[model samples]
Target: MEGAVISDEQVDLLLADTLEQYGYDFTGYSRASLKRRILRLFTLDKALSFAEFRYRINNDSSYFKRFVEQITVNVTEMFRDPMFFKTLREEVLPKLGTYPFIRVWVAGCSTGEEAYSIAIILKELNLLEKSLIYATDINPAVLDRAAQSIFALSYMKQYSENYILSGGTKEFSGYYTANYSLAKFNDDLKKKIIFSTHNLVSDRSFNEFQLILCRNVLIYFDRELQHKVFGLFDDSLEELGYLALGTKETINFSPFLKKYKRLGTEKIWRKIQK
Candidate 1:
């Protein structure tokens, strides 16, 4: 009981069971990452046995929800990788500004920090009135928190510094009001955002967007799944639209390589072909 180990076969069984019972397809995710997260959750929950863990995940809806949340990556912060945001502010958003109405999609948006960050940029650029930001994630629990527009007050200082590095001139604290332990962002920033549940593994693209940000999410996927997601993004992006990824991700060797042109050294690419 001290050092419980989940076998490879058991992992496969759990993955298959999850798909069949909950319609969530984790089959294409990287096995190592998935297994590690699953084991961590198993230990964190202190499950009596693997069988009990499996049973609870398969039968109890609430526990299944928690299982999905725990396994999927949710780590995010506003203005993460400040240089990336700086590029978005200086190079990307201006070009997008010419469009009459801009549609931005933040896939795997986690708790919506990225989406909120984009909204702040749009507002500052005087484009918020004509923009719509769709922020999506696989887990509804995170979406619920995201919709609240409230974040831990403690992280504000770091986020503020990131904002400054990202070329923000205004006081970052102006965006939110401190309420003891929590910081509630202004309603104006959340007005243009629509938070919803979207599973990149199984969900089809719902709209064509001028800009799509799926940072730090693709690394957890296998090559095949990454290809599938690239195809989904291609279909969902408008002509000449931009796709941004995490610092560690790229479009190299993918079938869509010839279709996109990299933007400088940043992990952003613009679609140049149909």
Candidate 2:
């Protein structure tokens, strides 16, 4: 039977229970999106009622993990919105080269595609040796998949196209090897990355960074949470550091709006030097 419609109050209760039991907070996410994802869980499981769904989530830790993964939204591709990476290559990376070393944080780095993209850029610029990339996501499952650096072979065609459009000089296929259904990226590219499970909702900044990319992540958050996260990014970045957001995200409504200066047409922003 199709699951009975889950009410907003029930979803809120689930979010609260998730926070209390798992310590993962989703309180600040957009209500509509949260509702959709939660409803999807019910539909996928053929859950008959909200009570059953809640009971399953509460009793089965593994089920809860899957549920968390479902709601987190791991949609991403390498060099997505190619112009953004193009701008990073042309404008941002050159300026960053002045620094003796570079630290980058790719928050919500699902499946490590974007992090790998950045590492490829650094490699091209001969900066990989002096760079450290911390790629984090709230879902441990995604992190595990990301650390494997093995993506579907089907994606390579699109990724290669993105690479070419993003101003890549070398053959994009050179970076990875295809093994049947999977494509494994070069081990050398993986060396500089550190993958970890990080809860951005409740976590504090652990280190300063010269470049922080949290693209497509803020849109899921409500205004108040977006502001809070912007403040966190502002605190985490070095003066004159770069912040990159998703194509659809903007800094106009942020409390820290004036603190960042947009660079060209790309979603790249720079912290104004004091």
Q: Against the true structure, whose TM-score is highest? A: 1
**Model 2, global lDDT:** 0.92
TM-score of 1: 0.99
Evaluate all candidate structures by whole-model CA lDDT and list the values in order.
Answer: 0.95, 0.92
lDDT of 1 by residue, 59-122 (tens): 9999999999999999999999999999999999999999999999999999999999999989
- Model 1 residue 136 CA deviation (Å) reads 0.4
Which 10 residues in a row give candidate 2 its minimum summed lDDT? Answer: 1-10
What are the models' TM-scores? 0.99, 0.97
